[model samples]
Target: MTSVVTSETRFVRSGDVDIAYQVVGQGERDIVVGIGWVSHLELLWELPETVHFLRRLQSCGRLILHDARGTGLSDRPARPATIDDLAEDLVAVLDAVGSERAVILGWVDKAAGAIALAARHPERVEALVLGEALATTVARDDHPEGLDPAVIENLAAAVEQGSWGTGALLPAIAPSVAHDPRVAAWWRRWERMSATPNMAAGMLRTLLDLDVRALLPAVTAPTLVLHRSENMLVPSAAVRRLAHDLPDGRLVELPGADLAAFFGDTDALLDEVEEFLTGTRTGADAGRAVLTMLVTDVVGSTALAAELGDHRWNELLDFHHREVRAALARHGGSEIDTAGDGFLAVFALPSRALACAREARERLAAGGLTIRAGLHSAEVVHLGAGVRGLGVHVAARVAASAGPGEIRATGTVADLVAGARAEFEELGEATLSGVPGLCRLTRLVDARGDA
Candidate 1:
């Protein structure tokens, strides 16, 4: 079992104000967490969900949590918050912690600050992760999902009227758990202690007119955007625009409405982040759940090795590697390993894995090689290298049982993608080696027949 990381609360001087920051774990890499508004360095540990999130982030690297100026234990700045102030504060915190370069993770409207920092100081940031980020707070001519002008004005007025705190905001931010009295009280207290009502109002007014869309193109770091499917605070459409506007950005729409990442379906959200940051999924929380697995085997490897000399065979293998990697990229699959001439990979959705398998088979055939692939969607343990459990064994057996130039999958995958641009032919139940009972297998057929 991995030990829990201990975080130390400290303060760093940025400009005229002191910024409160915390550093957890001792991993070589650095991941700076700048959730921006409403934070208290000591009080944040009171919430179990947030504590879990920080610990998980520490598992990836040395997690750096900070309360930006005008919020939490940090000193209030002299003037209203601007993009440059937030960016400069971020740099100061990084310098204080001795982090030369780090991955920046930001949430909601505050994410723009991190985005701006990455755009302006590319040398200080390695990558970026934005959750439910908003480029603009008010509705623009192109983005209709942003908050209405009337609503934004009303929000500024309400904050000025001392109507700021989780008691008034938790329902809108995390409706899934807003009804729970205990949850509400905890968040309310945290929000109240974060900042004075007047300070909160000034911050809200500053953000109302802020827009960072122009900085999207200037950001050179790789980025990932995670948005909730039914999020009300930040519309899913806005999240889509953020992903599209930013260069080298990938969007993942998780299932939930909670603007707070520590709410519903938090594990799925964190698992994706961990994998993206560390190139491995240390799935400590997501146990044996529904997962998609893809197994591929190059047909007639012995014959090919004999036909082509040793050096030429190795070259052909390299070509095969390129072909499969390209296919995986097109289909959103992660290559697990290349065991001999066979490849093992996984995907968040079964359709993608099946598409990659069929595409790879066709592309390999063009290069005078035949491949047999199998896919299965089942409960499996996700480790760093590849998945474990009986499901993986069954998938490997299914691939070996497949005929040359064929793509096979389990019935579960067929059921999952029934309405997609694909179908499956049931091949009856077959007893797989090193498995319990007989499992039903199916061959994938794209809309255009015999994929």
Candidate 2:
């Protein structure tokens, strides 16, 4: 049995405030993790399960853990909290540790910050593991089963009022252990170790309002996204969407309803995280071939560009890029590459890639830029940079065959999409170019009723 590694707390000064961190294990490779908002490093160490999880990870390499500002042992700075500031705090902790680069593991809202740090300083991030991560929250406006604006406002108001003790925010935020006694106790303890209600409210507000969906493709490190299938606060679909959008990301769906990392069977989570970090379980390139592929393009972008002229068209294209990229990130569609006015994306799950394409087309329609998308599932070649194989070519052909503002998918894609909450209109069979045989086509339609 591996013994508990002795951990020592250390402080690093960043500007006017001091950031606290703990070091565990000892190895050539270092892993610096940025804990989620409202964490107490000392308190977390006391939990047997949490300790076990950390120890398991520590066995692989040295671990550098730190608390975010305004929470736990870290000195709270008067500056307004942003994801950048949180990342800087981690950087300060790393600088003090005398390490140049380290693997980063970020949970919950820290996902965005982790990606930001990785994007800004790729050299400092050897690898990245994001738990329940997202590039942004801009999709909240069009979330399939998201909370109503009024409900969200009321919950935010209650969090602002009662802060940690408020029952309203706890259920939605930590649905995994909303009813479990032990889990609830642990949550309460951790909440108390951090800031008061107002500060908690501020953190919650930042989480809800901040949107960084466009940055998914900018991340430079190999990333692993662990999303719970039953997460209630952030819909499982939303997390699925995130997996599809990241340039170098893979999604592993764990079975659990609890959002908190320590609430569920942490061993399984640690196993996945460890395998990804250490490259013990066949690196990111060795995943199976059954995945969804989505290809999208503007219907008449050349004509639109010619009519609008270079100046206005450039501005419009920028807006289009921002909107489309945001949608891909929100829906978890990794932007493989962009054509003149098209995007090629691959997904580990067929349903998510299809859903993301549907959502993108629907949302972009308002901006007068109609998009056609096509999806298919089959064996794919994972080359790290982009996916290859006949399935990708078939999906591309399906996209070319689609009409303006329509989503056309091959028979395989349609079959996988059939049971999803979204509805589609079957367009019957069509012989796709270079494909072996005739393929059935389907067009995605608004499915609010089915949802």
Best by lDDT: 1
Q: Write the per-residue lDDT of candidate 1 for residues 1-451, one digit (tens) a residue.
A: 2444456789998977888998877786899988755678787677666666676777788878899888888897655678888899999999999999999998875688889899999999999999988777677887665655665567667766766774777777789898989788898888788888777777767767779988988998999999988876677787788888898899998889887877777778988998898787775554445778899988999988999989999988988999999998988888878887889888888878877888899899999889999888888754434566677887798899999988898888888888777877899999988878888989865555322
The lDDT for every candidate, in the order shown, is 0.81, 0.74
List the lowest-lDDT window of 10 residues for candidate 2: 279-288
Tens-place lDDT per residue, model 2, 1-451, is 2344557777888767788888887876898776665778887776554665576667667888888887778876553368787677778888998889988888877777788788777888888888877656535554443223455456557767655653445576566557866656766777777766666656766776655576667787888888778776556676777777777878999987666676676667777886876657432233236767888899898899999999998887777788878877877778888877888988877777876886787778888889898898888754435666788889899999989988877777767766677777888988888988888888877555221
Q: How many clashing pairs per prediction, in order?
A: 0, 10
Candidate 2 Cα errors over 4 Å, as ranges: 140-152, 163-183, 281-451
Among residues 3 or more apart in sequence or in different chains, the pairs in candidate 2 whose N, CA or C atoms overlap within 3 Å are 176-258, 241-331, 241-332, 242-332, 244-332, 244-333, 244-334, 245-332, 245-333, 245-334
For candidate 1, the 10 contiguous residues with the lowest summed lDDT are 442-451
Index of the highest-TM-score prediction: 1
